[model samples]
Target: MARERLEIEAPEVAVHLDAQDPESLRRLVLEACQRASTVRTDHEPLVDLALSQLVRGTPDDNLARKLEELAERTDDRYLTAQEAADPNWATLFRSARLASALSLALREQTRSSVLNSIYEAAHASPDTAAFYRDLLL
Candidate 1:
């Protein structure tokens, strides 16, 4: 057997590392935030599909009922976990408004608790960010 070594490059991180100007760095960071938002919603469709199945299911009789009961229990647990991970509307709206208002400040490299929260919420759900972004505009 021969030994082999491989090197992997993280293209995303490289974008930030290669930035030579403040504006470029800010653009890269904003792009990263948007990418994070998209990644967070990747699992949402699967969860939605599961919920739809539960809602559309029909029980033929006792055996079907039993199977559905088991499914419901599992689905309930999954939904509960998903809910826990999701940011509430209030937080999402506030964050989007603040982030939008402070867009220049973000570029200027200012950090605050509110900004941090907004970034967190935005990464949790891109749709929430877009909702409030449009609402604020």
Candidate 2:
């Protein structure tokens, strides 16, 4: 009887990083952010599809229901945590939470377009436009 020895070799991997180059660093950061966003939404295919329809201003009952559920859950959690002590703080917190939820729901470009449309609508009303402009300034 004879015994033979088996050997395994690990594969080599290469990563390039140019710390001093601003453009390279910017590209790296952008790629990382894009990957992170994709991974964040990859687990929910139905939600992503529904949200894509929403981005196009399409009405979806499923999406609406999901959003309603999300809002209810968020409100419940906020109350459970007892973070609604101060009126001002509660309003700010809820607004910020809603904005964060929107960010997660829509893609970057769609979010920008939606927000821009909202701004435009605000400006379309002469009375409110002036107030909006004042707030911005």
Could you tell me the lDDT of residue 77 within candidate 2?
58
lDDT per residue, candidate 2, 55-119, as tens digits?
Answer: 45444455545544654564565565566465444433343234233333332333233333233
Give model 2 RMSD, 1 decimal. Answer: 22.8
Candidates in order, TM-scores: namely 0.23, 0.31
**lDDT scores of the candidates, listed in order:** 0.35, 0.35
lDDT of 1 at 58: 22
- For residues 6-87, write the lDDT of model 1, one tens digit per residue: 0012222333234435454444334433433333222344323332332333212343333334334444554565577854
TM-score of candidate 1 to 2 decimals: 0.23
Cα lDDT for residue 136, candidate 1: 26
List clash counts for every candidate, in order: 0, 0
Candidate 2 clashing pairs, residues 3+ apart or interchain: none
Count of backbone collisions in candidate 2: 0
